[model samples]
Target chain A: MAKVPSELRYSKEHEWVKLEGATAVMGITDYAQAELGDVVYLNLPPKGTALVQSHKMGEIESVKAVSDLFAPVSGVVAEVNQAAIDSPELVNKDPFGGGWLVKATGIEPGELANLLTAAAYESFLEGLATSGH
Target chain B: MFLTPLNPLHRAAGARMVRFAGWEMPLQYTGILDEHRSVRRGAGIFDVSHMGRLEITGPQALDLLQSLCPTDVAALEDGQGQYTVLCHLTGGILDDCVVYRQGEGRFLLVCNASNRPKLISWIAGWQRRFPGACLIDRTEALGMLAVQGPAAPGLVAEALGTGLLALPRFHLGQGLFQGDPVLAARTGYTGEDGFEVMPAAAQAPALWRALTERGAAPCGLGARDTLRLEAALLLYGNDIDESRDPFSAGLGRLVNLDKGAFLGREPLARTKARGPAERLVGLRMVGREVARHAYPILESGHRVGAVTSGSYAPWLECNIALGYVEARLAEAGTVLQVDVRGRLAEAVVVPRPFYRRSAASGEAAPREPRAASAGA
Candidate 1:
């Protein structure tokens, strides 16, 4: 029942990325949001900060616990989503849309090779469920 | 994992079950924040049958309890209960318990689920000296439910009648449910005015149904934990354990050394003369960062202490934590830092019980209400 829009590519760490030309939009996936329960706070890098592929960028905290946020691609941060920062529950409500965490540009297009397409991500989720995650 | 008597009922209510202290109990029915706020603002019912319930009876029951617990159990008249701790010979804590004097020669001890097995063996060892006393594990035979919040007393009164409503806080009384007697005690871990009721295991489903129908939200362990933390009630394994003593854990007020030769009396008396070197203090995060367990507490750049328990207090809407620090640094207003996953997050020593309510006969907790002002 987890939403996986076919247009976006996903990271194994549960981050999703949508490439529009040289620009990329990123946010946590539906599976990650459901696992996090209620999102309460966030600590993402400010604009102009550099990000490394698969590296920890910041933290996401819920009422229950805290988790590290990993970057899906190597790029210079262009803008951090101000709306999601103001109201974290938006991530729990809409992980794919208004909950987008970052917008960055200048990433190599070949980064898609390291990310999974919608079809691949769905199977990965299914594998996790069968293994009792 | 072990199952409570109401396991099936919890599943039927769509509660998300999780393993805690060897039992598969509901982590949440709807959500932890929702359930936590319900108990703080109104009423919530929790199926706490997984917690241990032990009964002791005999002419020497009082004598045995007095020798085992640090609290002055001899002073508890019938129908009264006191929050106390079981300690080791070296003054280390064994477990925290609420000892209730339910009858002339009978007593009931409620303990944490994780410490149940250890407590049974510990009490048995002490029972050998009290020849006339007997210990019975009633945890499996009875089902326990905690109905808590501001409206709890009214809900309980309506469902079970005026018998339990008439009892004051920390008192016990008897009431009828379907013509069967159930013991109701005015005690709870959530710092809310409420009653913890003990019914026959077979009647658990009916009791749960009746309470929920009467407007008590079916809560789970997740909210129960958050509520107790906001009240600053120590979790046995997470906060206090065999390695820490009551004095160091900020429970010295419950120790009555002059009462007589209890389990930790000798060492506790010595500790009373010379204050504990480390004291448990409350910590308020200055921002969104959380200081989880084992995270180092820093004074300047050196490690001073570590967090025991930390989380976002839903009702209070702030991040709070409990940790042990040097006696000199335990005072409120002392600023410190927590190494939250390698990043230094500013924190300050604040007063305990991050939240309080009228249900427990306490003033509103005078702690940081907002993380923004915690730094100053």
Candidate 2:
């Protein structure tokens, strides 16, 4: 089973977001990393880039496939994780911690409502597991 | 889906299964990187039973095969195998194959599984002209395993109790495993010293078990693909197809047009004289991002070609690709650009075979330790 900590909010795109006041730190969930296999490369938006909620912000490349990473909430990119960029395996090792991809500040209030709670994301993942995706 | 004899074993080994060319095969066991490293450093075994094997035997077997395949089949003595291609009348490649001469009047053709039906029909259509020859599909009754890496020969000898390293490159030897006949050929796609063994279907499971128990890492198609790509070996469906000819794909050496009249010979000769408009070339991405299949190749902001195959070559520790570009721009070191999912990235033309063994020794030479990392 994938971990869905009660503290962080989740997106249908599989990103986990932890809001710190107006700043939101985000990374792909553990379930996302497990599905991706070995993460080889990551292309993240640069700092100060404006992102729209649910829009594609970047891409994550695995050995077998490449996937688009979506923005969970609209805001200006505040910081990009250089450690995750340099060594992509970190995302596979500690996706919930050091693997955090980016931080976004000046978040909109309505965007948080669009995100899923821990319980809701857990059920969503359960649906995906049973569906044989 | 069709299953190889080792399907049960793959599942037991915790393989991630996928549908490939109408067969249920393992995409990876443990991981592609780990399996790839095992083959490059130690040894790995691949269940390639899905490949099609056809047997041709008769007084006219060699003559019939020579007329269809582009390789110089008449030059092959008994026990020798040569990589060649089957072509259509328009000089389009039908499929690439390895033809093995078993004896004076017998031959074997190993082909891609997905093209088996087409190849059989194409060959059968010419049966009337060579009534002395007999073609038999041995795929259903036979199983193939590729034991690869530097340690492959020793591991295989210990498992089957027969020395195979003595077999020269492209040579086949007959041996017995548990008293059953098996054929070992010093051939592989991984660009490493290895042997491909063929045994009866019923005996495959046992043979696989013994090989793995003796330290042959069980690998899957995922690693097999990366290894072949790193070696610059062409995948039929991806790198060569009916839309392209062997000459344009950088395999002109295999097309023996001077030998005589053959299928696709006239067009191939004409194209050889005129030179190809597009030529296949190897590309090493300057960026970390991979340029996958069908991605546009650009030269000076203009679309010139498209990628046929691309990946993060685990062994090279770099993103590499194979693609056909305007022949004038196919020279090695030619800087190009590729649109990787709308992200334009720099790519440079490099010589084929992105990786090579340190020593230019024969196929059976002892293995050397690989670099600790790509940086080395």
Candidate 3:
């Protein structure tokens, strides 16, 4: 079963956000990691780069395919996770914790409201799995 | 999508299935990287039943094959196989094939699945002129498996209760397993020592089970592709087709121009006299970026060619690709740039067969391994 911790918010693109004060720590969800197979490389934006909600920030390449990473909320990137960048397999092993991709310092409150809560995201995934898509 | 004989087995093993050339084939069981590494370090078995098989029998089987195929089929002794190509009248490639001489008057041709129907009709049309020859589509009647890697010989021996290491490369042998007849050929697409097995379709599940239980990691098409690419193997549609001829694809040795008349032989001879405009070469990326198919190849800010197949080779641990470029720039050590997405990444031309075991050890080929040349 895919892990969906109740404290984190999610994006339809399969990104997860753990909000700490005005900063949003973002990473791909467990379900995303599973779908990606083994993560070999992560192309994350540098610190202080401006990001628009749902826009492509960088890329995540596995052995099979290349997927674009999207920003969940409009913000300025505060810091890119060096640990995950150094060892991409960590994203597949611990997507919710150390695998966090970026920490955005100035997330827009209105954009955060548009993100799905953990419960909503779980149901959304359930709908996707059941719909046979 | 058509199902293979081992469809149920793939499903039971939790393989991620996908449609490939009209067949519902397993794309991956665990992950492409894992399966790829397994085949490189140990052994992995792939259900390749989707590859088309044809049987030709007649007193003049060799004559018919020689007239159609570019390779010297007449030179093959019984139980030997030769890689060859079928071409159009215009000298464009139709399909690449491996023809095995099963007996004195019988031959088995293995071809790409997607080209089956067209090839059947193409050969059948010529068979009409040859009174004694007969053609049969054995694709649906037989199931295929490729057991590949350094550990393949031991695992195959354990599964079949006999050692096949004695069989020389490009040789075929008939044996029995689980009361069913099987044909084992010392040939594989992956640049590893292995066997390609063919048995009755109904007996596939039993063989698949036996191999998997004996530790032949059940691999899928995803790994099959990456493995072949690292070996510089040609993929039909991507690497060669109607637009490319054998000489241009670096398969000149396979074409027997000295042999008598054959389809496309004249055009091939002409093309040989005036060398191909572009030549296929291996490319190793200087950076981590992955170059995918159709990505532009640049030479000093000018577009030169496009990538045909590219991927992160697990064994090589680097991004490698195969592509065609102007013949003048096809030599090894030539620097090139590949446009990955929007950014141009540096790459270099290298010799084919990016990976090969030391010739002194294992069942490594005595000759330098042939570059996966041409699409046949």
Candidate 4:
């Protein structure tokens, strides 16, 4: 079973959003990193780019495969995680905390309705696990 | 789905399984990078039983093979093996293989898994000419394992016996495993000092377990690709295919054109005369973006060629690739660019074989420990 923290919100595409008032910190969920497997590169959007809710934000690549990263909420990119960008393996080792992808401000709180709670995401992941993917 | 004898073992070990060449096989256990480094720095074991193993025997066996292959099959003495290519009538490579002369008038041809069915039916058609020859498919009956790295020989000896290491490069020896005969060959795809042991299908799991128990990390096709790519060894479907001939693929040494009439002799001779238009070259990326298969190789803004195999070479600690560029731009140090997902990444032409072992298995020299040799 993958870790789905109770406090954080999750997206169906496997992104996690932790809203702090007007600012929101986001990263890939633990389930996302395990499925990605030993991330080697990231193609994150630069700061100042406006990210739309549940949209393609960037790409995460492993040695063998590539997957698109999705944004959980619509906001303007305030900060890019340089530490995670410098060391991609950190995403594999710590997907939630240090591996956070970006910080965004100018949050649209209405978008939070589409996000799932910890219990909902856990059940969603279980649904994926049993679908034989 | 086709599965190796060790399929259950791989599942038990929590390996990530993937489908390749019609067989379900492990893609990784721990991770690709971790297993790649394990094989380069220490020892790693690979279950390569999925590759086709054919047994050709009879009085006319050598003659039949000699007529089919561009390689000098008659040159191989008993117990020796040589890496060579099987060519089509157009001089395109049918598949790359290693032919081992097990004994008088007997040979074992190991080939890529994807091309096995094609080769079997194709070779059977030629068997009509050599009424004295026989071909037997031994892929299911036998299982092959490659134990590779600098520490491989020592560990193999410790687990099996010291006599196994006495065999020279490209030579075969029989090792005793629980009173049964296990065929061991001093040949490998990983460009390291190692042995490829062929055991009966029933005994494969035991052999793999014994090696892993003795400290050989179980690796998968993921790492196997990286290791072989680092050495610039051709992957049949990726690097050399029926659409491409051996000479253009940088396998001219395997083609003994003057030896005699063979399958692709005439076309190969003409190709030798005119020279290849596109030559395969090694590319080292200046950045981390990997140049994946079919990505266009760019000289300027125009497309010059395409990358065949590209990856972050775990051993070299840099991104490396093999691709066919225009012959004019194949020279070393020529700057080229690979369009990595629409981003042009800078790359330069370097020599083939981006990695080489200090004492590779190709050398005929005995590599027993200095301590053991000093006493003797």
Tens digit of lDDT per residue, candidate 1, span B1-376?
A: 7899999998888787888999999988888888998998889999999989999999999999999998999888788889999999999999998998877779999999999999999999999899889999999999999999988877877777665655766867777789877888878989888888888999988988999998999998889888998999998878888888898899999998678889978888888889988888899999978777788899999888889999888888888899988888999999999998889999999988788675454222222221111000
The DockQ values of the predictions, listed in order, are 0.66, 0.74, 0.75, 0.76
Model 2: pairs clashing at backbone N, Cα or C within 3 Å: none
Please provide, for model 2 over B1-376, each residue's C-alpha lDDT reduced to its tens digit, 9 standing for 90 to 100: 7899989989887788888889989888877888999999989999999999999889988878988988889998778899999999999999998898888888899999999999999999887799988899999898999999888877777765444556678877765689766887888999988888898988999999998998999998989999999999999889899999988999999988778878999999999999999999999999897988889999999999999999899888999999999999999999999998777999999999998865544463544331111100
TM-score of 1: 0.94
Which stretches in model 1 have alpha-carbon errors above 4 Å? B359-376
Clashing pairs in 4: none
Per-residue lDDT of B302-370 in model 3, one digit per residue for the tens? Answer: 999989989888888889999989899999999999998889999999999898754543464334322
Give each candidate's interface RMSD in Å.
1.1, 0.7, 1.1, 1.0
The collision pairs in model 3 are: B96-B376
Residues A55-110 of candidate 1: C-alpha lDDT, one tens digit per residue: 99988988778888999998989989889998998998999999999988889888
Residue range B277-375, candidate 4, lDDT tens digits: 899999999998888889999988999999999987877878899999888998999999999888999999999899999864434446553211100
Residue B77 Cα positional deviation in candidate 4, in Å, after optimal superposition? 0.8
Tell how far residue A129 is off in model 2, in angstroms: 3.5
lDDT of 1: 0.87
Lowest-scoring 10 consecutive residues by lDDT in candidate 3 chain A?
A: A105-114
- Local error of candidate 1 at residue B324 (angstroms): 0.6
**What TM-score does each model's chain B reach against the true chain B?**
0.94, 0.95, 0.95, 0.96
lDDT of 3 by residue, A10-127 (tens): 9999999888998999999999998888888889999989999999999999888899999998899999999998888899999999899999977778787889999999999999
DockQ (0 to 1) for model 3:
0.75
TM-score of each: 0.94, 0.94, 0.95, 0.95
